[model samples]
Target: MPKITDQVSDSGIYLLEIVVPDDFYTEIKKYEGRKFPKGFYYYAGSAQKNMRKRLERHLKKNKNIYWHIDYLTSRFNIGKIFYFNNCGKEFECDLVADLIEKFGLIPAAPGFGNSDCNRCDSHLLYSEAPLDYSHFISRYQSIARFIPSSNDTF
Candidate 1:
């Protein structure tokens, strides 16, 4: 597993592996003209100034719903978080495209968490199973390498 050794640069991209258990009832009926089932939801997001704060807000249970991902995070629990420390802005969309093109992962909903990016159909990807973290750590190479953080449940 990857570890967090630096705290200076909080700017980077993150992928949230949110798991809605098989028995869990998903509250979102429809979003952006699409429907999603109970499964693993991967949301790609970036925090240029404060990644820690952005992540904390996402994991918080009682926060207000602002982003598209909040609709789900407010209802379900996040299973894992993977991040690229000190990374640039472009990687947010690149990461989403990687999952769709290389891993064959499909978008959970169109335009979900991708209002600012034109390169992706959505920043959220869905799978019927768990995601393999090794894929990012092993095969991918960016200016700032992707690492699995020690953060768990905020």
Candidate 2:
């Protein structure tokens, strides 16, 4: 298990681990119908204000689906949340790009979670295996933080 730090930031970047159990197709608002296979997914996002509240909303079972991530998290369970304190929004794109370049992780959906981002193909990445957070932390030692779902609280 990874340790949770006591330090908290009002705004920062976060990665959500989502698990889908079977193959299924569903339409997401304006995007094309998406096909989700049984596997794990990682979504990177940023909240520039009230970061803890944003994360808490994601963990809630009942809420209005507002963002692309909301659509997914509303359907599937989020197993973990890895975050970085005081990280700017740009770091969200950087993390996604790094995952693509270094880990060869591809987007599960082309425009998922990046309607506003011009630099990233998508903020959501799919994988057969869980991401190695230790490796990411080793590379970004100064900012990386980990919080498993069991320990996450507002």
Candidate 3:
């Protein structure tokens, strides 16, 4: 199994979080004291079986454009894409949303709700607050970035 590096992105560079089983929290040890850039990032993903294919579609200059992240790709070319595994269908959606909120970066679109976690209403998703990656450290250790895996290339 490949690692899904945890990621962070700005309009210019995208950070990543590696994908690992939800039960495991080993790699996070490596990110201690490392800094992640702060800015608006569209968080979108699916349970599609092919990671490479999904990344290709996401990297495409023209795509179906369904999720908010897809549309944002137009505004800002996706600088980097992070991949995660064990993020099974059941947990992927909620887990992604949870990570976003737990990190404290304003959910790409907060109009959907203050919290991006699946528990909130999924209507009119929009960000009310500005992107503040620094704020995320308040919620969790800045080191957790090492635990997840994401791609920096394409």
lDDT of model 1 at position 115? 87
Clash list (residue pairs), candidate 1: none
| Overall lDDT per candidate, in order of appearance | 0.74, 0.81, 0.37
Off by over 4 Å in 3: 1-38, 64-67, 110-154
Q: Give the TM-score of candidate 3.
A: 0.43
Alpha-carbon runs more than 4 Å astray in model 2: 1-6, 151-154
Candidate 3, residue 118: the lDDT equals 53
Q: Which window of ten consecutive residues has the lowest lDDT sum in model 3?
A: 17-26
Please, what are the lDDT tens digits per residue for candidate 1 over residues 1-154?
2244455257888888887875344345554334468788899999999887887788787888777788788878777777788778898888888898888789977777888988888898988987666665576654434434355332
Return whichever of 2 and 3 wins on lDDT.
2
Write the residue-wise lDDT of candidate 3 on 71-119 in tens digits.
4443344433333443444444554455556544333333321234455
Error of 3 at 24 (Å): 38
Ranking by lDDT: 2, 1, 3
The clash count for each model shown is 0, 0, 33
